[model samples]
Target: MTTPDTQSCTACQDLERGREQAAAVRDRSKVTDFHVLIARHRARHPAADEAVNVMREQGPRT
Candidate 1:
């Protein structure tokens, strides 16, 4: 099965766009900006659900 990012979906494109925006403003990104980026990324890429869910279950990495 194709992953969301590899599927060339709109959301995936949006995520890439977001990343670009973040990179463009890297020095200005605040805590809230990071949170927003993560939230948007998760919202746009449901196909990542399996991996994300598994990670959530596994807890934070050291």
Candidate 2:
């Protein structure tokens, strides 16, 4: 399940997909790039950052 904000955020979806693809292929550089992009996104969107922190606290979804 995705939050309403996440579902509506194309940039977030794209970055996550890019990161997943990079990780699947063991492309550390691309993965790092996506992480950087996500960090930048979070810096600009405090709500998103907070959501991520909450999710982290909850741990991984099963």
- lDDT of each model, Cα atoms only? 0.62, 0.84
Per-residue alpha-carbon lDDT of candidate 2 for residues 1-62, written as tens digits (9 for 90 to 100): 64566666789889999999999999999999999998898576657667768889889776
Each model's backbone clash number: 0, 0
Off by more than 4 A, model 2: 1-4, 48-62
Q: Give stretches of model 1 more than 4 Å off.
A: 1-7, 27-62
lDDT of 1: 0.62
Compose the digit string of candidate 1's lDDT tens values, residues 10-35: 65566556767767777455535655
Candidate topping TM-score: 2
RMSD of each: 8.8, 10.8
- Error (Å) of candidate 1 at residue 46 is 10
